[model samples]
Target: MEKYIEIRGTNLFVKYLNPDSRKPTIIFLHDSLGCTKLWRDFPEKLGNATGCNYLVYDRLGYGKSDPMPTNPRPSNYLEIEADILNDLLIKLQIDSAILFGHSDGGSIALITASKYPSRIKGILCEAAHIFVEEITLRGIYEAKELYKNSNLAERLEKYHGNKVDILFNAWVETWTTSDFRNWNIEHFLHNISCPVLFIQGEADEYGTMAQVEKTVAQVKGKAEKYIIPNVGHTPHKEIPDQVLDRTIDFILQLAH
Candidate 1:
């Protein structure tokens, strides 16, 4: 069911798939430009595959949630997002959960797992970045061009509605700023005590293998990596079957 949950003083849009199930919750976090709807049917599919409940939400500034201030976002915004996720879990009475996050969301999942280790069961990070890379900037630059010259805004409007421009600029302006060039979150990786599965596409334009390698290298608990060839940044979207199968296997293993 569609619902609005007050979190961090804002009504964040949320949806639950298989909420009646007695299985563990797998919370899905979207990318920079994504919302609960943008995750498409992956949450339902994953929930069925893993026999888990699923939760997906739009952050404060994306989807149907309240818009954030247009001021430059901090480099620690992911950390803030992690805290907010924890708050949402508490408000929902969820004691522990598995996080499935993509891009910026992936980074947030990692941060949440590390900073609030007691509540996280496991994490699945897809195309998550631990440090800024030159390719990331280049990809952002190209995306900015697409936003300006193509129907990118129109396309995103299908999912984001009127909040498309604000959400788009928030990500573009913040990431492309000079101050954000050195942004990194590797320090928090070591604190994560839960099992982590790092999934990346071999052809991801925004980041390289270093992102996954560094994540698996530093985490204190059990960790695994899966690099899907011929796929770009969004594996759940690009190759749903493979991503689902692998993800289900990982979660099943975690259960044992």
Candidate 2:
């Protein structure tokens, strides 16, 4: 069943699909410009497939959550996300979680997992970016061009409300900047002490297998990566059944 919970200043709109009683809590974090709606039915479908506690929530200023007046810097983001997520879990009375994050959300998951090592059961990072790359900048530049010519803004507007500019510009301009190239989280990867499963599409436009490979090399835990062929950035959305199967198998192994 699904219901809405109210945050002190903002209403926390929630969508739950199963009753997870003592099962590992699996929290789904959306992509860079994704909301709960963008995930469509994956959350519910996966929830039923595993019968574990599945949760998906919009980040502040993204979906139903309160929008911040400014975009947060990358260095400050992971910690801030961890703090906010800790608070959110407390409000929901959940003390631990198994997180699944994609793209930017995957970075957020890495941050949270590294910062609060004791609060997580496992982590599944999909299309996660650990360092900046030339291809990344080229892709962002292409995205900016496409957003101007295509309905990218229109499609994103549905998720961000009328202030699409507030969300889009910041994400684009920041990552592609000359200064943002030095963005690296390899130092923090050592702090993550739980099991981690890295998922990435072979043809992901945003990043390549290195994102997952580097993580497997750095993190001092049981870590592995699954690279699906002929898929793009949003593998779960593009290949739902395959993604569900892989995720289910991974989770089941952890369940033991």
Q: Which has the greatest TM-score?
A: 1
The CA lDDT at 89 in model 1 is 90
Give all candidates' CA lDDT scores: 0.90, 0.79
**What C-alpha root-mean-square deviation, in Å, does candidate 1 show against the real structure?**
1.2
Candidate 1 TM-score over all chains jointly:
0.97
Clashes of each: 0, 1
**Tens digit of per-residue lDDT, candidate 2, span 134-186:** 77777888988989999989988888787577667767866866667788888
Candidate 1, residue 54: Cα displacement in angstroms equals: 0.8
- Per-residue lDDT of model 1, residues 1-256, tens digit only: 8899998678999997655545678999999998888888899888887778889999988888988867468878889999999999988877668999999999999999998888789999999999999999999999999999999999999887887888888888889888898899999999999999999999999999999999999999999999998999999999999999999999887766
The pairs that clash in candidate 2 are 61-67
